[model samples]
Target: MMASRILMQRVCCVLVRDLRGSSSYSSSLTASATVQPFLSRTVLRSSCRSVSFNVQDHDDFTERVINSQLPVLIDFHAQWCGPCKILGPRLEKAIAKQKGRIAMAKVDIDEHTDLAIEYGVSAVPTVIAMRGGDVIDQFVGIKDEDQLDSFVEQLIGQ
Candidate 1:
């Protein structure tokens, strides 16, 4: 993939250079016209996997979850929790179905105990939906795919 992308970039550069001499348009405009589609395609490919992410710290949480324009589902879980293991993937799948409509922040309770406490998480696999820094909804324990889907749908609706 990297090789192909590099090759494509080289080809585009050559095309832009050739067009620079053949056309009356400015070289910058010619280069931009040649590169815009490639840039957009790369962005589209990356956006598919940008819906979910792991929380790093309080500051990271604030930046990603609290400040997000899109509604966010904060998954507070622990590595040692059995139910968390079950719900994590199901939550991700549900979020994936929503595409870029919403985002999920996976917070490991053990790593970020302060966040769990602040969010009132008393159990593993606690899913909290937030929009504009305010909590909209939440649930504890594992949920089936249908339930998760409905939960995400409800979040998006709000």
Candidate 2:
């Protein structure tokens, strides 16, 4: 679950100009590159339940997530659910905010009920984290981008 330090620097100019009354996008502010952080395996092992964010299909889940090099985050959701709707935009914003470092995927429980059932997703908007495809972290509710970032950083401490 090791990751580089993440910052709130991935916001777009339109977002900044809209939120901060400033159109001037700074290189230090809008940067979205993923830097590989140095982490001792022991340190990473100490923080096992770190959070991750990414998106991939159920079939591709194993190959891209479980087996891929980057950690994975899965958002289990259903379109009819309210919290899922709210979390959806937040995660999209996160995707924009942490462009290259994190990956995010949304699972429609209704469409992929089997995956949901296998993962024991009893609720909508449940987020799960995996390192090398093994279930390593999980949360049962909606998390804003900052909270999500902190959760993941705790594992890899990016």
Candidate 3:
């Protein structure tokens, strides 16, 4: 019984260590864990705010992107897409460098299927640039940070 208790303690320690190291653990475990309230408040505060945000719905898209005074860059992506994840941060970084001249809208294909279909997005990580609610430029695939910077510059007519 003593040896079993020691093994259980070791297992608990390993589980705690793994949870602390993982990025998704805060979201997945906080709701059900006893330390939920504290974790939710602290963990949810940290998010990407440099140059873009997750577009919530169709109405939000209309207000935030189409009606925006600034040129908007829309990134159509899916959570399960590996290339989308790779390209997203790079695009954000490029947009951040542009200051307030441009804005970025992120659309998850799984959540916004209609938007994806309307835009004729056949694959993940399709980026479209819009000005005056019209598509000015677009590209599909992973672009390096430098290429993304050039793309943003072109969109803003710099």
Candidate 4:
């Protein structure tokens, strides 16, 4: 019984550390001791339904984007691309604003050369909006948040 209680306290400390990031250890300890179960449920629900995820391969791409029930926004990017780093998160924020009306698929261009070539991606941060397995719209380069939001809205017919 003592060992189990210690383990539970340790788990709570980790949870508070992860959730708050740089939280005071004393406060985290207090919160964890008082509100561990509630915090755990909230964290689980949010993390499980993340809007964006990386495409593992061509088959994964086909399964997720080409056959998705919701319209998909594919971000063709590379790790070394500066613009891609800037745009990827912005695009994700825009997609999240839609509240499950759309989904975002991240594709690493360097890893998926064939997909980049097939899609005619000549630059990093190439965004492709697709529906019904067809390319509905595409643009190459980083777009500002408003432009990204408008692009997404247009695809979902908003």
Steric clashes per prediction: 0, 10, 0, 0
Q: What is the lDDT of candidate 3?
A: 0.81
Candidate 3 local lDDT, 20-96, one digit each (tens): 79887768675676656544453333332234767888997998889988899999999999999999989888988
2 versus 4: better lDDT goes to: 4
**1-158, model 1: which lDDT tens digit per residue?**
64465456556555555655775535555467755566446543344336788887899899889999999999998888999999999998999898789999999989999999999999988999999999999999989999999999999998
Candidate 1 stretches with Cα past 4 Å from truth are 1-45
Q: lDDT scores for all predictions?
A: 0.84, 0.61, 0.81, 0.82
Candidate 1: the clashing residue pairs are none
Candidates in order: C-alpha RMSD to true structure:
8.1, 14.1, 13.5, 9.7
Q: What is the lDDT of residue 40 in candidate 1?
A: 48
lDDT of 4 by residue, 1-158 (tens): 63464345556556755756764744764666646556555443344335576887888789878999889999999999999999988998999999888999999989999999999998888999999899999999988999998999999993
Candidate 2: deviation at residue 1, Å? Answer: 34
Error of 2 at 61 (Å): 1.9
Off by over 4 Å in 2: 1-58, 155-158
Better structure of 1 and 2 per TM-score: 1
In terms of lDDT, which candidate is strongest? 1
